[model samples]
Target: MDVRFRYSDHLVGLIEDAAVAATRIATAPVSSLAAEALRAKRDAGRLSARLDASPLDDATADAVDAGSWARPAEERWLDEAAGEGWLGEPAGRRLDEALGGRVTGEPAGDAAAAQPADGWATALKLDGMPTQQVAAVEYANLLACYDAESELTDQLFEAPMTVLTTLHGLICRGLVAAEILGRPRRTIQAVHDGAQGRVIFNTPDPRVVPRLLDGLVDWLGATGPAGSAGLPTLVVAGVVHERLLEWQPFEAGNGRLARAAARLVLRARGLDPAAVAVPERTLAADPGGYHNEVAATVHRRGDLGPWLEW
Candidate 1:
C-alpha cells in the first residue's frame, strides 16, 4: 500500500478545511487590538522589505534577525509596567530571565544553543555523534509564510500544514539524533504511520471538507471585527482552535493544525503568537487529562469549557 497517497489525502482534507475557515475570518471586523496589531504587522513588514532590499551591517542584521521589529513594542510595554511597580519584582525577574539578559536581544544562550552549548557538546562527545542540529528549516518556512502578503484564501491551508510537517519532521530528526529511533526504522515507521490513519473529523465524505472549511472562513471574516471586541484575540483564536479540533476535518495532525491555527489568529491580533504568557503549556503537562478534555468535547458536541479553562 502506498502510504504517501493516504497522507496526501488526509492533508488535502485538512488544508481545505483550514482554507475555508481563514476566508470567513478574513472578512470579519477588525478589533481595536487587531487594528493596533495590524499597524505593528505593517511596521514589521516594512522593516523586512527594507532589509531584503538593502544589505545591512552585521550588527544591524543581527538585531533584525533577533526579531527586534517584533520585540521593541512589547519590551517597552513590559518595562514601563515594571518601572511603575505594576509588575511584582519576582515576576519581572522571571520575565527578564526568560528573555535573557537583554530585553531587546535574542534570548541568552540561543547562539550557543544553536552551535552546541558546552553540556550539549559534551553529551554529543560521549554519545560519539555529531551535535544536534536544531531544525532551522522549519523556522525558515514559518518566517517565509509570515513575511508573505498573500490572502488567507491563497495560503491559509498551505501555511499551517507546512508548519505541521516541519514540526513532525523536526521531532523525528531529534528522536533519531538522540538514538531513540534508528534511521532505517525511522524511515519505514514514519511513512507507515503517516499513511495509515484515515480519521477525519466531522464528516467522512471528502466533498464536505471544502465546504466546511469555506464556512469557517466566511464566519471568521464576517465576525472578525465583532469577535475582536468582546473577546481578546487570543481567546477568540483559542475558541476557533477548539472548534476546528472538535470538527477534526482530517485523519491525523488535527491537533497540530489547530495549534497552528491558534498561532495564526494570535498573529492576526498583532501579538506574538508563540509567546508563552498563557499557561497553555501547563495543560500539556498532563497529557492524559488533556486528551480527556478533548475527548469530552468530541463526545458531548457542546461546550468546551473544561478544555478552554485549562
Candidate 2:
C-alpha cells in the first residue's frame, strides 16, 4: 500500500507560499552573490552529509580498516556501464575516473602514496594522515551527486530507480561490502535518536522495501515530470526527503542520500535552481528540532502536514 499522508488547509497555504517564492526565485536575475551563495550552499551540504553520517559525534560510523576499504569495488557492471556511455558523457567520465586506479589494478596518485597503518575513514577530513587514509569512495560520492544533478531530465524522473541506485552505489562504495552496493537492505534496521538515546523507529522488512519504493515512484509520477509539476516544489522536496528516510532502503548512507535527493528535487523543481538556499544550514542549526519533527511525522503514521510546514 502507498504510505498514508494527510494534507491540511494550513499545509495547502504553506505550499502556495512556497510556490510564490519559487516563482520569484525562478524569474530573478543573476546577482553578484549567486556564485558565493552557491558555494556556501555546497559547503553546508557537505557538512550536513558528514553530520548525517555521524549525528551525535564526529566519529565515522561507516569507517572500516584501511586495508579492507581502500580497494574500490571492482564491479564489472560499473565498467561495462561506463563503456556503454550510460547517463550521458559527464556521468560516464566520472564513473570511469571513480574506478580509475582500481580498474587498472594499480595504485594511482595520492591514493598510492598515502599508506596508512589502517583503512580509509570516509565522511570528513582526515585529521592525521598516519592513521586515516582518504577514501576514494568519498570522491565517488561527490561525482555521483554532481552527475545526478546534471542528469535530472524528465526521463530520469520517469524511472528514478536508476539514479537512486547509482547514488547509493557511489555513496556506499567502499564503506560497505561490494555485494550490497546498490542493493536494498536485507537485514532489519533501527534508527536511534542520538540526543535522546532511544530507538526512534525500526525499518520495515526488506521484502516490502521494493514495493514501498514503487509506491514512491508512483507518487513521483503524480507529482509530474522532473518531480516539479502538480505540487509545490517544497512539498515535493519534503516528501522525497521524508519517504527516503522512512524507507531506509540502503544499509548505510541513507541520511546523506535523503538530503541529496531532496536537494535534487529542489534544483530540478526550480525552487533552488541557483542553489543559493541552504536548507541544511537551517537543519543543522536546529538538530534537536529536526529530529523531533521527523519523529513526530513518523509517529503520526506519515501524515506529513507538520513536517511540510516545519
Candidate 3:
C-alpha cells in the first residue's frame, strides 16, 4: 500500500535554504582558498567550519564567492549553457500556453504568462524510444523523482509548487524525456558489485535502476521528508542528483534528467525558479570532484553521504 501521507511541512523551509545556498554558491567566483579549505568554508556545518577558522562568514563568503567564483579556474565553459539559452523561450511559452490551458494537472495564471517571450525556442520531446519495450519488473519507476517530491508536496504538504507543480506551473512542460518521461531505468544496473565497482570505474548498469528507485520511493513514501533523518534539503538534492546520474536511467538524457530533477527540487523547496543559481553550474565547473564523489557513493562506500557533501 502507498505510505506517502506522512510527510512534513518543514521541508519547505529546508528546501528554501538549500535553493538559496545552491544559487549563491553556483554564482560565486572561484575561491583563492585551497581546495580543502574551499570545501570546509562552503559546507553549512558550524563545528566543521570552525576547523578552518577563517574570518569568512556565510553572507560575506557568499558575496566573495559569487563575486569571484568564475573569475579564475576553468573560465571556458562558465557560460556554455547560457548561450544555449535556446530552451528558455520554448520552455517559457510552453509554460504560458499550458497555463492558459489551465489543465488541472498543469501550471496556470499570470505568472505563467509572465515568462519572458524572447527566447530561442527548441523542441523538447522524445521521439524514438527504443522500439523494443523494456518490460517493467515494475512500473512504479515511472514517477521516480517526481513522484517522490510530488507526494511530499501534495500528499504531505501544501499542493502548491510541488514536484509536479512549480513556478508558472512550468513543470507541466517537458521536464523530462518523452518515452521514459518520469520512470526509472529498468535496464540500468550497477556495472559491478559494491566491492569491485569501487576499484574500477564501470558505469552503473541500468538494469537495477528500477528496483533501486522503487525502494527509494517506498522509503520516502512511508516516512516522508522527515524520513531522511533530518538531512538538509540541498544535501538531499545532492544525493538525488548523484544517485540518478549513477543510475543513468534513460538510454539517453540521463544528465539532463538528473539536473532537471535537481533544479526542480531546488525550485520546489523555494530556490526562486527565476534564479540562475543551479548546482549544475557548480558540478560543471568541478567535473573531477563531481566524478570522484559520485564514484565514491557506489564504489568506495555505497553510502550517499560523500556525494551529498560534494
Which predicted model would earn the best lDDT?
2
For 106-199, candidate 3 gives per-residue lDDT tens digits of: 2122122211211101122323422111111001121222323323332322221122222212221232323222333334222222324443
How much lDDT does each candidate structure score? 0.36, 0.59, 0.37
Runs in model 3 with CA error above 4 Å? 1-183, 186-200, 203-205, 222-226, 271-274
RMSD over all Cα atoms, model 3: 16.3
Q: TM-scores across all candidates? A: 0.36, 0.69, 0.41
Q: TM-score of the candidate numbered 1?
A: 0.36
For model 3, give the 10-residue run with minimal summed lDDT: 131-140
- Name the TM-score of candidate 2: 0.69
| Pairs that clash in candidate 2 | 65-119, 66-118, 66-119, 66-120
> What does candidate 1's lDDT look like per residue over 1-310, in tens digits?
0000122444445445545544555555567445644444433323322221212233443444466533222213233323422113564354334333221111112121122112222222113322211212122222333433222222333333323222222222221222211111111011011224432223222334434444454445443444233444545565666655554443233444455466566555544432212223444456345545655665665554455555
Which candidate would rank higher by TM-score, 1 or 2? 2
Ranking by TM-score: 2, 3, 1
Find the candidate with the highest TM-score and give its number: 2
Residue 144 in candidate 1 has what lDDT?
A: 36
